[model samples]
Target: MTETELLLSLIDDKLRKCEDGYMLTHTHFLSLGERSSAMAHLKNRYPNHVFWGGYPDAERSVLFLLPEYMEKDDFSLEDEDDPLCLVRVRASSAKLTHRDYLGALLGLGLERSVIGDILVGEHGAEIIVMKSISDYLIANFEKAGSASLKITVDSIKNLEPPKIKTEFIRESVASLRLDNMLSAVFGVSRSDAVEAISRGMVFLNDTEATKPDARIAEGDKLVLRGRGKAYFREQSGTTRKGRLSVLFEKYI
Candidate 1:
C-alpha cells in the first residue's frame, strides 16, 4: 500500500481503538508533512483529537485519538500518563549536532517515528521520545558521534529546548506573493523560489504551499525544505520603487 494509505489505515485503527475500547490512543511521531496530511484526511470527523509533540511549536507531532468522553484539552504533555518522555543527554564538552544525535539513536536501532525533536545545545542534546523506550535509552544510549553521553530520563516539563537563534532580514519585494517573499528572504532567484514551491518544497504555516503566487501576509511562517524557516514579521513600509519593505525573522 502507499504511504498515505498506510497512514490512513493506522489512523482508522487508532480511531477504532479509541471508539471501541474507550481509551486514549496515539500514533508515533509524525513529520510536518505527515501531520498535515493526516489532519486533511481526518478533518471534522474526529473532534477529540490533537497533534502534539511534547510542546506547542513542535515541528514533529503525534496524533492523539481520544474517547467520546474526553476533549483534546483533557490531555497534557506534562502529565505522567502521557506517552512521551524527555531524555536529557549531556556530554563533557564535545558539541554534538542534530545529525550526530540522530545518527547515534538510529545506530541504536530505534525507529525515527519513536523520536520527536532533537534539540542540540552547546554541551549535549535534549530528545523527546516515546515513553515505551525511555528506560532502554537510559540504559543503552551511550555515544553520539564521538561524544560520550550521559543519559537521564526526566519529566516532559523538564525538557528545555535550545533557544532559537534568528537573523532579522529586511528586504524589498515587488509583491507579497509566496515566491517573491521566498526569493527576498532566502536570497534565491524568483524562478528558483517558484520551482521550489511547485515541487512541494515550500510550506506556509505548516501546510504545503503549492501556489507560487499565493499571497503571503505578515506573521506567516514559511519553510523551504532544503533551505530553512522564516517568519514574516512585518511589512514595514513601501519602498521608493513601489516595492514592499518586509522584515523576516530567519531561523539561523
Candidate 2:
C-alpha cells in the first residue's frame, strides 16, 4: 500500500471500540485527499455509527466526529454530561494557527435549520454526538497518541471560552513613509520595513507606492500587498521631523 493508504489502515484499526454497540470518531489535520480516504474506510467498516468531518479551509486542518459511546439517559440531550474536549497537538508545522469552533457551529446552524448547544474546551473545538460519538472520541483520543491527546473525556465538562486580546487595531490611510510608519506600528526594524517598501510590496491607497519616503496623508489607503492593509491619519503628534505620531489600523 502507499504511504497514505498505510496511514489509513493504522487509523481504522486503532479507532474501533472493543465493546459492541460502541461508536467511533476520528479527528485529524490531514490533507484533503487523506481525509477523503479515511471517510471511505468508515463507510465500509462502520455503517451504523454517525460519522462527520470538517475541513477548516482557512486553517487547513480537518476534524472528524464519531458519536457512538455517549451516556445518555433519555432523548432529552440539553443536560448531557461532559460532551466536549480539547487536545493540544504538536503538529509537524512550526507555525500555530487557530480554528474558530464557534464559527464552524454557526455554519452548521445554518445547515441544520436548528441551533444546538455545543460546549468546547478552551484549547480546541467541540464535537456533538448522541450514543456513539463519545466512544469514538475516547478510542481515537487514545490512538491519537499521548502527545496528541492534549485533552481527555473529563475536561469537556462546563468548559469556558478562551480569551484573546487584540494587539493592534486596523485603519485605512492614503499614503505613508515606509521606514517611519511600519517600524513603529509593526515593531519591525526600520531597515527591514524599508527593504520591503523598496521591493514594491507597499502600496499607497491600493496602488504600489515604491518610494520609501512617500508623503502620506489623511484618507490615503496604504496596502502592503503581502503583509496587510492599513490607513493613515493626520499627524496627532511628532517625536521627530521624519517620525511623526499617526493613527493607523493594521489588518491581522
Which one is best on lDDT? 1
lDDT of each prediction vs. the true structure?
0.87, 0.44
In terms of lDDT, model 2 sits at 0.44
- C-alpha root-mean-square deviation, each candidate: 2.0, 15.9
Task: In model 2, state the lDDT of residue 84.
Answer: 32
lDDT by residue for model 1 (1-252), tens: 998789989999999998999988899999878887788777878867888888777888999987878767676644667888889889865667888899989999999999999887777878999999998898889887777889899888877655778999999999999999999999899999989988878989888888999999889999998799999999977988999999999999
lDDT of 1: 0.87
For residues 32-103, write the lDDT of model 2, one tens digit per residue.
344445556666665443222221111112323344454222211233432333333222232222333334
